[model samples]
Target: MTAPITQLKTIEQQLLWLSHWMIHHANHVRPKVDDIKVGGHQASSASMVSIMTALYFSALRPEDRVAVKPHASPVFHAIQYLMGNQTRDRLEKFRGLGGAQSYPSRTKDTNDVDFSTGSVGLGVAITSFASLVQDYIAAKPWGETLPKGRMVALVGDAELDEGNVYETLQEGWKNDLRNCWWIIDYNRQSLDGVVREGLFERIEKIFDAFGWDVVRVKHGVLQRAAFAKPGGDKLRNWIDTCPNQQYSALTFMGGAVWRKRLMDDLGDQGDVTALLERHSDSELAALMENLGGNCVETMAEAFASIDHDRPTCFLAYTIKGVVTLTCRQSAKASR
Candidate 1:
């Protein structure tokens, strides 16, 4: 790994631990006045950690602004704490009265939150408007002196179901929005369940119609490297064709299940079988689970590859609670 990638991975792990720990502390350790459970979206925060780490630590400039996903408040607050923008007391008081707000708030939060995000799709919608406003300011003589920056939204995949997001897309198309980015955490799994298969195809079409560039980040470095092997193409095809729920379940079930499924499907094929034999169960499991959005290096590369000022959407594939799963596996192995 490059020095930058190493640094990013370290930061990613720290954010993952801090965010989950904050949630655990809130739910289990903190003194409660009532019998209510203090719910923090631990999985949601885990899904965004690598993406946010790449964005904030590697890709983002000082002028850029981001509207963090509402459910990822823990990750955002953890990032702020790492940057010395948040206090330890506030972190300990997460979700409590006079504590870190359940969701990021511009008026309430002491840290530098560019956009207050709480409503389902409001955070995703506002980035386009903010980009428009930025353009409007630049058109003015005095405002031309201000530095222009990208208005970005860290969006949850489920948030795309909101009608207002589509409405904002139409408005943005009409207004010719520029320098806006919506990075969707396309984890497939949502609160209700796994999202409908092929949702990304429809989403791509919608964005294309609205004059926005769509970048689909599906596979990570590990998967891509495997695909370059002798029987890698067949393996890649199998992964591509696998149903979303099945893939998720297999991932949860870990490597032995993956081996069985792959062997059953592609057993007689000499090259494919050899490829499977190359890796142990845990290694195979890790390879299969390393989706693009969950890989900090892959996310950083995606962010860096965007060379235009036009509005863009990065549909980044990830796994919900992947960080938590990894931590659990690590603990189990250590025990």
Candidate 2:
């Protein structure tokens, strides 16, 4: 790995540990007067760790603004804590009264939160309007000196179901939106259940129709490298055609099950069999789960590859709760 990528990996793990620790502390360590569970959304925060790390550490600039996904508040608070913008006391009291806000809040959060995000689709919808407002200000004579910045929304795929998001898309198209980015965490699983298969295809079409560039960030470096191997095409095809729930289940089951499934499916092909034998169960699991948005290096590269100011939507594939599971396993091992 390059120096920058190595550094990013370190930071990614730190953020993951800190974020999960904060959630665990809130639920298990902190004394509770009531019987209510202090839900910190550990899985939601884990899914966004890589994307947020890459965006904040590698892709974002000082002037850029972001409306973080509501469920990712733990990760956001962890980031702020690392940057010395949040206090440990607040983290210890997560989801409690006078504690860290359940969501990123401009008014409530002491840290630098560009936009307050709470309601499902509201945060995602407002970024386009924020971008338009920025443009309007920049066009005026008095506002000529203002530095232009990207208005970004870190969105959850489930948030796409909101009618307001589509309404904003139409409004943005009508107003000629620019300098905006909506990076969707396409983890395939939501609070209700697995997302519908092929929903991304429809999402891409909608973005294209709205004059926004759609970038599908699917495979990570490992998967892309694996695909270049002799039997890699079949593996790639299998991943592409695999149902969302099946893939998620395999991921949750870990590397041994992944190996068994792959062997059962592609064992007859000599080249594919050789490819499968190249890695142990743990290695195989990591490789299979390393989706683009979950890999910090891949996400950084994707963000860097975008050169235009036009509104863009990055449909980034990720494994929901991957980091949290890893953290739990590690904790058990240490114990």
Compare the candidates by lDDT and give the number of the best one.
1
In model 1, state the lDDT of residue 91. Answer: 91
Tens digits of lDDT, candidate 1, 1-335:
22277677788899999998888999899988887999999988988998999899988878899999999999999999999999989999999877788999998889989999989799999999999999999999989999889999999999999999999999999999999999999988887888998888998999999999999888877778788878999999998899888887888897899999999988769988878777778878877887888778788899999988989999998888784223222222222
Flag regions of model 1 displaced more than 4 Å: 1-3, 324-335
Model 1, residue pairs in steric clash:
none
Taken over the whole model, the C-alpha lDDT of each candidate is 0.87, 0.86
Worst 10 residues of 2 by lDDT: 325-334
Judge candidate 2 at residue 175 and give its lDDT: 93
lDDT of 2 by residue, 1-335 (tens): 12287677778899999888988888889999987888888888888998998898899989899999999999999899989999999988888877788898888888988888988899998899999999899999999899899999999999999999999999999999999999999998888988998888988999999999998898877778788888989999999888989988899887889988987877769988877777666667877887888888788888998889999999989988874223222222112
Which portions of model 2 show Cα errors greater than 4 Å?
Answer: 1-3, 324-335
